[model samples]
Target: MNAPTHSHPRVLVTWESKHGSTAEISYAIAGVLREHGVRVTLSRADEADIDDADDGFVIGSAVYAGHWMKHAKHFVQEYSKKLLAKPVWLFSSGPVGNPPKPDEPAVDVAEMIECTAAVEHHIFGGNLTPSR
Candidate 1:
């Protein structure tokens, strides 16, 4: 549904990035949403100020050892109430190199999905160094 010009629907894009890649992805998502005329706000998960006024949310995190970063987990826990009441989407970035199909949600985000009743959960392939 589209909102009137006076009140454009706002979507918050927040994420916990370990090496800036996740942040870049978050920004790209925000840009696309903006191009579609949706008001978007990009913020770090730990620094995000999620509120009831937000129409939707796109939360992301960098997965480490099959788990989302700590700040991302805390962010979800801290704002579970507000997030659950609105349209929310969850995403995680990990599993470098050739992307493999994951049968299930990441360890940390699984609980968040249940808690927020998220509309969808997406897992993105991450960038890793050769040494890593």
Candidate 2:
């Protein structure tokens, strides 16, 4: 018998954050992968000119007033072709500060996830207050 596994080569955790929290989240995730002896690369979404990384973590922090920071959205849109050809995951940081009102629209991260063929997707609660 053989252990089931993926063919992914490396893991990349890329994020675009405001007030630094999302970066911290990605860093923590990267740290865990490193501890497991997995090769990992991390960069700001704005700097991720990645065609593909055997496996990828496409993290994006939510910007309520608008949406994901432009750079993060661009990273995905710009690399949609490459991402769809490989495994990718997206994450966001937000829901802080002014809580989204009942009328506030819900952010839909699914469309992007499906387009990327990402093995999985996740959303972690983040500080919404600007004071931090």
Candidate 3:
């Protein structure tokens, strides 16, 4: 049989943000993926639809007290079996300061990777405003 044909890879970019910083990062990622011709579905983790038709996933969350937001954690736990069958990437956004304090990864990152079999994880500097 001829090799199966497929459309552009579809990626799900989902995030949980309490102050909107993490969500912005997710949007940027989705934009970059789109620029590269990948089809992206951007949504909040709690509201994201886990579709098997997606070829990969990029999940992110705001880190609070060294842990990922609950909605993000629940999303990964809820769809981990499906995630493991595809390419998965994880990100945590939190560390606000001139030098970006906390200089360490989120506490639950290891567990999340284990659950999702994610290929990579990234930690991005966060944005915090006094008014927030």
What are the models' TM-scores?
A: 0.87, 0.76, 0.93
Could you tell me the lDDT of residue 125 within candidate 1?
Answer: 80
Which sequence of candidate numbers ranks them by TM-score, best first?
A: 3, 1, 2
The residue-by-residue lDDT of candidate 3 on 7-78, one tens digit each, is: 799999999999999989999999999999999999999999788789999999999889999999999999
lDDT per residue for candidate 2 within 10-96, as digits (tens), equals: 777788887887898889988888888777888888887674335655556555563677777777778788787766767766655
Q: What C-alpha lDDT values do all the predictions have? A: 0.84, 0.68, 0.92
- Taking the tens digit of each residue's C-alpha lDDT, what string does model 1 give over 14-108? 99998887888899899999998999988999899986668999999988788889988898888888888899998888756454544445777
Instruction: Note each model's CA RMSD in angstroms.
Output: 3.4, 4.8, 1.6
- Candidate 2 clashes between residue pairs 3 or more apart in a chain or in different chains: 61-93, 96-128, 97-128, 97-129
Model 3: lDDT of residue 31:
92
Candidate 3 versus the native: TM-score?
0.93
User: Candidate 2, 14: how far from true, in Å?
Assistant: 0.7
Report how far residue 86 has shifted in candidate 2, in Å. 1.5
Candidate 3: pairs in clash:
none
